[model samples]
Target: MGTIKDDASLVEQALLQDEESKRYTGDGSVDFKGRPVLKQNTGTWKACPFILGSECCERLAGYGIGINLVSYLTNKLHEGNVSAARTVSTWTGTYFITPLIGAVLADAYWGRYWTIAGFSIIYFIGMCILTLSASIPALRPVECLGSICPPATPTQYVVFFLGLYLIALGTGGIKACASPFGADQFDDTDSEERIKKGSFFNWFFFFVNTGALVSFTFIVWIQDNAGWGLGFGIPTLFMGLSIGCFFLGTPLYRFQKPGESPITRLCQVVIASVRKRDLVVPEDSSLLYETPNKSFVLEGSRKLEHSEELR
Candidate 1:
């Protein structure tokens, strides 16, 4: 992996890495370690598709779970709309909040690749469990007596919610990392590469919709008409394929190093602001703190410039 001098501060270290990356390429590229930044100098399109494909299939698997869940609850377990919808809404809330935890951890410690990979594995296992819960006669919901369907037993509730939460945890982390990791493939310093990054995001959303469309039309239909085994199994297969696709681009993909913790930085800002609340505002723009280097201003995104907005 690439690195800067140990003595330098975060901003300086980032600046040096940026300069080194741009300046050092080809036979003249990269100093000290002598490793090339691009192994085959592969273009962005080639490397990015694997990630895009992974996300597409991932969405197919995830949304496949969502599209017909109400029907599964109502028809199979004889749950009312209010009850099933409430359960699903609770699960959805957990799925959304878990991503924030994942993002914080990813920036603080794990690189995007590892975080996404780890969470994906967890997600796959969860999907498998879900399939088993649906397919196995013992694990699945029982038919209702007349119009009244008994609530799930503790054992059944535990088994089902466990699998659901695992998917949430895995997809949450994957969601935070996937786009930024894909964007990392393109060289921001190059205008062409930047444009390619923008294009990747556009297509990324397109693929998401494509997955949702297939899920609603095909996966939902399969669950309705075919056996639940086949319906759930299809998305599981897609997820398996998605994981395989992500690994295929390993050689070509550019891996990024983890940096300073966002959690800590946020704490510092809040704490400092509260502590200095009584202090007089400085009129001079130059009095504000900023990195010396233009190249590496921000760790996560961009460097902030001293401006009238502060006043």
Candidate 2:
């Protein structure tokens, strides 16, 4: 904020435009078209405690599982070190990379709020299934045959991977929306609110580390000393609490409409340029067909026809 100067960018103006569109009703909810009317709340530091607290718990729940994943695979699953490492790597890679897909879904279709909410359920379900697989006799390895450990049966494989990949998908959605959603709670127009929003990111990272720390220490200990079931179960409980806290803050959240997808805009640009390639290039910028309204057109971009007739 300090270093950057000059005029505000088009995205900033678009953000302001979004803030302006929020129609606050006398009722608890605000008027938004696609989803159910969102609970109206001012985006302020005062109202952001719920979002922060929810994030802490969500991190704790999510981190608890991954931190000790190698141990669980090696000890309980009776997997060799190399195999366990590979499995953990694949699982984590999937968890992180799927966010790109989720971001498109969030920005292009579902708004951030609903994307987070919907995915939180999927995450919770994954946690439950993972816990169940860890605990149940049939889901994990049965008896060790002499020196070599038996591989997981087809059913066990299905149960375990289902839990693992659901987690991947769910975490992807959460990662895409959570931070931006948190920042969305602040009114960017106000100097004070904008500062608070910037300050919030610093605190958010702090809390995130706190979650990872606790999971690595306490949660891992429980799994090692007590049982895998108890370890995995604790995170599931925290995840539920995380979801509950998120919903509880509905009245305090600063909701926004989903932004347009860059991919879609780019594709539109390409299509329009290619279709008009052989035609004479217009000398005047005004000659290009454009919509007057800023609401629908890409910010700081040449407005393309909204109609498919551009083809």
Candidate 3:
């Protein structure tokens, strides 16, 4: 039989390769290789377990590091309560703030999958550094004796914090992308998949708290009873597992293409508004710039009606 072309727009170009028999997903998502994906084979709940698994371990790993940090700083590093508290607060802020950088990169350039994968390596390296800092004698401060404790040397401070900040950078990318990446597995255009997407979020949060719970309860106890080396080491190992789990589910994952930078879009809006500051408001909402087509002006998005409240 002669091959059929995907181009079927009447009376022309029918002599190409046969059309794909697969029922492609309607959500405009593609497989990891950028080809159309079969709806039944990829994504949905099948891919969620891996994502959830990764999230759980990652959250566990993150909280494992953070929960006992104040104690480590004061007791092990010989930092004063005030200094330790300040350091913890600053590190926490940096950890959260770095997500903005991840978000921009995911949206503008790297796409979510690559961003998560790339940052996870950084996170793992940081965890390893932290583990070594705890396990190696030279990396950690000398043990305290009685009432008088020597301060942590400059070398000790450098090694510990280098690991700490690297984790901040790694977790930033994961935090920014993981949830949305999970959501991408479900097709928004399909009614069934859309409902499933809601359920996905519910399970996603459940796993998140599950991880946190384990870290606070089990990991905290380990740090207290066990040596610092083992305590930090457990989380580091889990962080590695987190990376493994994510990669394990790579084949089942659906990917969305990165679009224009949101920051750039925001700037364009502000500039447009400033230039149009003197223009009178139109009485009819239909007078606003909006296309009536099924597709939106923005790629991979639906058209939204203009709202008068925003004006």
Q: Which candidate leads in TM-score?
A: 3
Candidate 1 vs candidate 3: the lDDT winner is 3
- Report the C-alpha lDDT of model 3 over 1-311, residue by residue, as the tens digit: 12344345432533322233336776678898998888888999989999999999999999999999999999899999999999999999999999999999998899899999999999999999999998999998788778888887899899999999999999989999999999999987778999999999999999999999999999999998998899999999998999999999999999888888889999999999999999998997586767667566665444554677867
Per-candidate local distance difference test:
0.78, 0.77, 0.89
Per-prediction TM-score: 0.81, 0.75, 0.89
Best of the two (1, 3) by TM-score: 3
* Tens-digit lDDT string for candidate 1 (1-311): 13554545677878988867664222122211324466346537878889999999999999998778888777765668999999889889988888897797777787777788889999999899888878887786677778677776777767777888899998878899999888777766567677888999999999988988999899999999997878889998999999999988776676655667888789989999999999987897465666666644444344444567756
Cα error, residue 267 of model 1, in Å, equals 1.1
How many clashes in candidate 2? 0
Flag the better candidate by TM-score, 1 or 2.
1
Cα lDDT tens digits for candidate 2, 79-140: 88999999999999999998897788877777778898999899999999999999999999
Please state the error at residue 105 of candidate 2 in Å: 1.2
Q: What is the lDDT of residue 124 in candidate 2?
A: 93
Ranking 1 against 2 by lDDT, winner: 1
Give the candidate order by descending TM-score. Answer: 3, 1, 2
Q: Which residue runs of candidate 3 sit more than 4 Å off their true CA positions?
A: 1-22, 280-290, 298-311
